[model samples]
Target: MAFTGRDKKWLKGPRAVALLAAGAAVVLGLATGGTVTQAAPAKPKPTHMQVQLLALNDFHGNLAPNPATSSSGNVNGTPAGGAEFLATKLEQLRAAAKAQGQETATVAAGDLIGASPLLSAAFHDEPTIEAMNEMGLDATSVGNHEFDEGYKELLRMQKGGCLDDGDGQNNQNSCPDPKSRFKGADFDYLSANVFYENTEKTLLAPYTVKKFKDGQKVAFIGMTLENTPNIVTKSGVEGLAFKDEVDTANALVPKLRKEGIEAIVVLLHEGGLPADPRAFNSCPGISGPITDIAKNLDPAIDTIISGHTHQAYNCSINDPAGKPRLVTSASSFGKIVTEVRLSIDLATKDVDRLNTLANNHIVTRDVPKDRQLTELITKYQKLVAPIESKVIGHITTPTVVRTADDAGESPLGNLIADAQLADTSTVTNGKTPVVAFMNPGGIRSDLVATGGAVTFGSAFTVQPFNNYLVSMDMTGTQIKALLEQQFSGVNQAANKVLQVAGITYTYNPAAAPGSKVVAGSIKIAGQPLVDGTTYRIVTNNFLSDGGDGFPAFTTATDKFFGGLDIDAFASYLSAHDPYTPGPTDRISITS
Candidate 1:
């Protein structure tokens, strides 16, 4: 079953015999002094093919290099990640593979755009799309963030065009280049699990088959996490139903096999975490949704490239038949690239699973930058320069950061919640919101005290979703149900504890999910929350629409849409100059 170059002659026996016969015929014709013609022998079949798969995930439209202190950090103390450097690294990888007669493909697991930084977000992620196209990405899965602007916008991102109804006066020119209308993604975006609710058909292509020069084919099936709708803005996924990831991938396996594509790879938007956070290349004590999904995958699948948790790990998980299958992920923000080498046996037309090798490579900054990518970054940087450097506010202490505690309470989260509460306190309807809740996911980054001053870009980076505040009325019982829901159902795995303002409660982690929160412990403004009484609540529109698995918010009454979350946060910071960290006593965790 193992193939080495020396055994290639056995697989090419028939072709060699045909070539020998042709040579004998030519010799006989020359001996007779008569012109004779014979058909040329067919090209010899390769005994094996080597394919290099270069993958990254959760890029999040970081066209420029992120600061070492931020999301893009040193891998073993080496500064890493910049699109220019990433392009260079990818080219180097492909060149090395080519020298050994191998083919290379650049792919992604998803979140290439949306929730992006100011540079790329300014033009609605057109720049990021262009950057990927330039870098020669072959395909990518659709992450939840890809649905942030709704399916129609996602279609635009794929098909190429400008936003017809641009985002306010500020975004009048949605397309970055006026000389050319936006050209859509050169790479294919796969989404096997997402289907239109009415038609029951896939919204996009389920999978894509890539063929090598020697006719060896590999199919890539892409899908996001099954609970995508729960985390994304409800309106974005209103007409779509996200099916189970494993079921979707399994269903496609037979179809691909029927097409004679024995090599299958899954580009999934869900990922796992390893025991040691620093071990990027080794999988030790790996655990998460991806672990279970990988183990249950059909034996036909050769590899699983994943993302979404934004952690890096290269694991060899066994499939259902107990065959080892490679599963890998690259850290987020273009910080790393996962290079997977798959050996395909031409004889069986399937992957030589035993010979596959995978590892995570850092996109170190020491490499020379790609000049084109550098120019692209410079173009976007100049466009966002005005708003990127404006001084907005100040952080008095470094501890006023986004790092959450055991109960998921963070100084920045508390501050953001308080800002939303204050913004909705005096609405035109005369109904005031007494409590505010911020989803931990919505807090993208920490408010690092750089020289004690925070820029407009820094504030925007912390709250980049462009979410609007929505105030509503919920009963104390519903509020309690929401708190309890955080530790159960779809959320139980991640345990996304909501950040609270003007509310406090203790929860026991050892208790059952439904009974985690201590009864009679919930209080707001020194008063015990009465089960029958109603309280005004304010949260981002995503949460109000029951995002993050908080279904209780869907039943809220008297909903009122307020200002943008970032604006409220900025106004709050402006009012409280030199802000200090708040007490983390809001949500206490009990064992």
Candidate 2:
């Protein structure tokens, strides 16, 4: 059923201090006025319950300020992000909320562990989780990228595992103990709809209930995209299935309600926030999914924190009951923190009918760094310092990370795709790479041109994720099918075709929606591509698993080694020095 919107009850009542002390006393089996009982104080109806939810998403383990943007923007519009500065910001936010006499819960929308800078990736995501624990994050929803290493590795990261250092030793020299590979987090990981196929129950708990002062209880439900199986390595989630978000929430809410939890929030790894609402610049109508989800979700759901497509928007829409449901998403990369204050009535013990607030704070690094978080990050930072600061490759031209309206493809993306295709082709003994496609979303940052000198550090900053290269054999018709997926909707977001190497195609925007690619529109090495001919193509593991809805790559045969795709791109850049894009070298799409 289509989602229908409703009016929300805006916050309007006078500010009142929460009776958290009373709530705590009740939980502790103490008396406030009448009697001390063993019956949990009859749920101890709260007089007032105020909660502060601090959220961040897509922090791809950027422990240090990327040298690429050092010359320009800083975290808080200052210089750049250093652990010290970011720690300070997180701590300040938490402390300030506490000072205001409000309970706080720090959370994230995932993409925090995988594709991380060298420090965490090298150690198999431990460093990042440890850093997160230090930052006081309470819970997180899994992002697609979190499954980068597949499910077994994700489990290892969660329950701890072992690593080798090429010395054939049982453990890496740094971590002699197997248990040291992944130090588990202090917070919870929620995945409501994801489950083992046979059981049909959540692979993980659907949500976690957190208790606070004045007997106030809150529930958090987590969900990734329903098509997670399509975007994750088949082996990673071998026996798992991802159910629809709405269905998942509908099933779980009743369970939480039964547990005496009335206030509920959803931390979904999906997204809808756009960089510019009016401009619709890169991803137009990016908020579609999140908005639709919010409108249709049961009224029991009070708020939704989202991520994945890293645009930021702060607004509130209503549920089916005409009661306001607050929705907030902070800008990615630790650049912003979304703070939501949910006020509950002291008398009714329900969400305050007239006074709840949603605030999206831009986490500027301009503030003093938090010492506690800084110190914790430093322990890992020192161990990761050498690798994080190392130079791996260089770029001569700007590399052109993004493709504009009139533009056909991006050089940086082409370089990465070509590297993957070439790398796999050679390793497989001269297997011709007919085409290579790289999802635009995989290229995290733009290939920035720093007037004078350029280094590998800059390149790492541009392509930070650890997706690997996988080659598949597909017919030309399948390739066309893939292209169609990128341009399906008229007012779609991120519509640009995935950038490619070793092939080119023209798309007709004026044509009817489904018939965009005209006859003979696609080419391979300047020759018309025959629909029936089988061709070997190369794409990152992310797409091979159908990320961003590019399912064609998953249909390919003959997949190969699964090493980091970014490393391959870096190698290509290193091998080809003085890189430059000619007028028509990378891509050309005509009207």
TM-score of each: 0.70, 0.67
CA lDDT of each prediction against the hidden true structure: 0.79, 0.63
Q: Which structure among the candidates has the greatest lDDT?
A: 1
Q: Candidate 1 versus the native: TM-score?
A: 0.70
Tell me the tens digit of each residue's lDDT in model 2 across 483-546: 7877775324546567777777676766665577767767887888888988878777668877
* lDDT of each residue in 442-527, candidate 1, tens digit only: 89888865798887778888887666688888999999999999999898887989999999999999899899999889999879
lDDT accuracy of residue 545 in candidate 1: 74
TM-score of 2: 0.67
lDDT of 1 at 28: 11
